[model samples]
Target: MSDDGAHGLTIIAFIGSVFSPYYGWSRAQDPFDHCAMNVVLYGRPGRFAMTERKAGSLSRSQDHIAIGPSSMHWDGTELTVRIDERGAPVPRPIRGTIRLRPSGITAGPFHLDAGERHRWWPMAPASRVEVALTEPGLSWQGSGYFDTNDGDEPLSDAFTSWTWCRAELPDGAAILYDVNHRNGGGRSLSLRFGFDGARRDIRPPLPAALPPTGFWRMPRATRSDDGRSRVLQTFEDTPFYSRSLLASTLAGEPVRAVHESLSLGRFRNPLVQLMLPFKMPRPL
Candidate 1:
């Protein structure tokens, strides 16, 4: 799937889950926290996906499944994925690679719709992203580029989203999202958690009664030239801490994006996260 497919649901669920808290709607609680896993792959894209359809709901807990080719390479310092899906009778094969380092990640200059070599191209063909990791999975900063063409008219915009993802082993955890360059009239934020290993789709509990041990603060915020805005989140929880960087495009004609992020977690109390029955402890 493209960057905005099923996995996209994960973010949607998260947004819905924490919609009230992030936007200052719910004062009673905050967004639920969970583990952040990175499965980077790139090379020969013959069609890969986290879900089947383009508009499917988030997968439930306990269901962690991604299928594609073996075009991913890990050099320990940087994980790289390259997709090259072009020139074919069907959907065009994909070949790309993702590179990740303790400091940051390098996605691509890989080439998507090079020379009419594929059956399809992104809804928006002119999208670019470049991220620099200043502190591994804890923090980072970067810029994104987006562009599109529609009947004698050209549309272009840029935005960003920064995230801090960290999980404690035994229980405690935290995450934050700062969004910019939104097309909709109103801005929104949300978070959610589900049982471990279950499908990544499902609405997370709202106004959660659980207590958080760490501290959350929006120390800074700013708006960009394209009407996109950015918010800063800082947090600290025992045994874990997380930070994210994000850049996204407006949700209008010819959608595009450029995003950067990082998450830090060290496996803490499971009770603090949304775990499925399979991940729950047995009754003594």
Candidate 2:
């Protein structure tokens, strides 16, 4: 999962028994379990730093996740993060503290598959972010978001394509979740929720395509209520997924949102599977 604030982004990734043998998964017992951390300071272009540790090095209780020099603690009300970059690979240095308090609205534990193989829970659909960075010396605060994705089986086994986006409104927030499955079926969720914890399902607008990715020709699109959608920034474009920041409207309100598209069909390709090791090298 990742947290994107106004000034920085932090990602905490956990690969379970399936993806353990790669990406520096733990070697102590089951060589396949691992956890990794990444921090990016938006001011420094190309200054993304990542660190990987064995699964045993991570500790996850009810509301806290601690690994190496970084930790995220959620106390049912607010989420707090403390990042220490002294062990990271990049040289320029990056470290910070972040706090996110929910606006009291959430969406789903929504089932993505008919058999309940995959699910999504929008824990904090909209949040107030407070940031304090000491490494390169920066400080700012703004709106933020948090969520979770979980599956009982591999993604390739159930899904072919998906597009998800969240927009923060003046009074609350909205989310559009659309998915296409491999079995010739699909699901769509257009939900709007308020800070007071009221949620309603609405119909989303037509799909609008964004520009294709540079390398893989991976397609990207989002549903906007006004038929106007623009890509503001492309954060990640891989063989099977694309993550971007977009300018769009939801429920008639102008919104700047984080958007993502995943192509499980591409991920199932033999060549894409072969290339995964390069991006996620395992430790010997």
Candidate 3:
């Protein structure tokens, strides 16, 4: 998920399993069996960290997952994130706490197919995030967003490309979700939800391009009502995807947003597959 904090934006993810045989090295039965915690600090090059842990060592009881010094607990009312550790391979020590309280706005567990192969739940379109970083001794509180996505199938098999973004507005928040399926079809959702749970469908503007990423030129774009968008920071840029912080307008309001673009077609490429092991070495 994307977290816009006082210091900067951060993206944390746990990619469990892919059905492809090429991913056999993961040694996972269920895709969620073996997982890794990936933390990306926007605008901080070489500060990213990924720690691998067996799913057995991780506890998932309802809304909490505890593994080592990091844990994420969500009890519907709030989401609490705690991290305390020195990163491997790079040795960057990161210790912090992040708390998110829902603003009472939410979107659907929107299904992409009749069989419900893909779905997303925008749990909190807008929320208050409190931050406390001990290792760096920084703290701030601000607006944040949270969402959850789950699918029965591998993303590369279901979609060719997708772009997603969330914007925090004055009275509420907005989300733009668009995907190009492998069957030459597409789906788009542009929604604005208020703090009181009111929802509106918005007509997303024409897509605008951002600067091409390094090495692979991962395509990145988003819809803005004013036809103006700027990529303020590029967090993680790989051959097939990119996560960025952007400044743009949605529903006639200026917003700073966390944006992401994923190209599953390129992710399926053999060359890209070969590079995965370098960044995701097996856990010792």
lDDT of 2 by residue, 1-284 (tens): 13344344645545452332243223453422456555655534334555456666678788888766788998878899888754333356667888989988563588988999887887777788887878767777777777777776667678789899888888888888999988988998888888765786666777777897777777998988877799987777788888788999788888887788889887767777776654444344
| CA lDDT, every model vs. true structure | 0.23, 0.71, 0.73
Structural similarity to truth (TM-score) of each candidate: 0.20, 0.83, 0.87
Q: After aligning candidate 1 to the native by TM-score, how far in Å is the CA of 35 from where it should be?
A: 17
Candidate 3 residue runs with Cα over 4 Å from true position: 1-6, 11-28, 44-46, 85-89, 105-107
Q: TM-score: which is higher, 1 or 2?
A: 2
Q: Taking the tens digit of each residue's C-alpha lDDT, what string does model 1 give over 1-284? A: 13322111011112122111121223533222211112221222212221111112223333221222223344544334333322212223323332323232222122212221211111211112222222111122221111111111101122222222211111111112233332322222221112121112222212211122335321222222244533222122222222222231122111222222311122222432332222221122
Report the C-alpha lDDT of model 3 over 1-284, residue by residue, as the tens digit: 23434355353546464423334444445555556555554433334556656657566777887765688898778889887755555677678888989878564688875567998888788888887777656677777777777887777778899999988888888989998888888888888889865787677677777877776789988889877799987776888888887999898888888898999888888877876765554465
Query: How well does candidate 1 match the true structure in TM-score terms?
Result: 0.20
Worst 10 residues of 2 by lDDT: 17-26
Which portions of model 1 miss their true places by more than 4 Å? 1-66, 82-90, 101-284
Ordered list by lDDT, greatest first: 3, 2, 1
Off by over 4 Å in 2: 1-10, 13-32, 38-43, 85-93, 105-108, 273-284
The clash count of every prediction, one per candidate, is: 90, 3, 0
